[model samples]
Target: MRLFGYARVSTSQQSLDIQLKALKNAGVKPSRIFSDQASGRNADREGLNLLRLKVEHGDLILVKKLDRLGRDTADMVQLIKEFDQMGVAVKFLDDCISTEGTMGEMVVTILSAVAQAERRRILERTNEGRLEAKAKGVQFGRKRSVDRNKVFALKSQGLGATAIAKQLGIGRSTVYHVLNNP
Candidate 1:
């Protein structure tokens, strides 16, 4: 059976050194390792997809942690199920969990559920905070980059939208929007 490894970091700024070292220590070859510098929330990971395509029946996929696979617990559970159906195995090194036994199945289920609930709670609190801020007249979107007064003055000087945009180093669309709205 072939041993494959997957590692992920939330952002490009983060390093994969630790996870790579762990995977190498686990006996996964460097050529058999796949990694993504992307959030677990993003399912369209190129590395993961390529690994998935390369895996065959009886192949083992190793990850450093359960969270590295995905942030959404339901999605994680579904992906594990898919791997099981494919006759492939998955092991989370840090979590000490594997898709090889009944106990592993139970633990994965419970932990995935808990993680999913936590994500839901986080989203609810974030939305509540955002709503409270909006109620207090907090502007949430990007601030205007161009001055409306300046655009108006330039237009009054017989300058077209393109000319005003070029002179102010702003977009022509912004110039049109300012003039049309006013």
Candidate 2:
């Protein structure tokens, strides 16, 4: 049976070196290893697509971690189902779970559920914090750089939105927004 390895990082800034090394140490050859410098939530990763195209029955797929495979529980579960249907096996090294047996499948399912719940909790906490900060008079988004008083002064001087924007080096949309709001 051939061994194929998959690795992923959330962003281009994060290094894939650790995952790659782990996959290599797990007996996955360099040529059989595939990686994507993209989010685990992204399904259209190029390397993963290529790996899917190349994988066949009796081939074992190895991942450094369950999360490295994907962040979304539904997507991850669906992928495992697909692989099982294709007569392929998946092993998550970090989690020490495999799709080769019934127990492994059960454990993976439970862990995936926990991971999904954890993600939801994190999002809820973040939103609650943001709302609390907003209630405390904290502002969000980019700081408005366009001077509203300057825009009004320019408009009074007979300069149109386009002319005002050009003079202030800001977008015409900003000038129009300032005029319309104030």
- C-alpha local distance difference test of each model: 0.89, 0.90
Backbone clashes in model 1, listed as residue pairs? none
**Worst 10-residue lDDT window, candidate 1:** 110-119
Candidate 1 whole-model C-alpha lDDT, 0 to 1: 0.89
The clash count for each model shown is: 0, 0
Residue-by-residue lDDT tens digits, candidate 1, 16-53 = 99999999999999999999998787677999999889
Stretches of candidate 1 above 4 Å error?
39-44
Q: How does model 2 score by TM-score?
A: 0.90
Among these predictions, the greatest lDDT belongs to 2
Supply candidate 2's per-residue lDDT for 150: 93
Give candidate 1's TM-score.
0.82
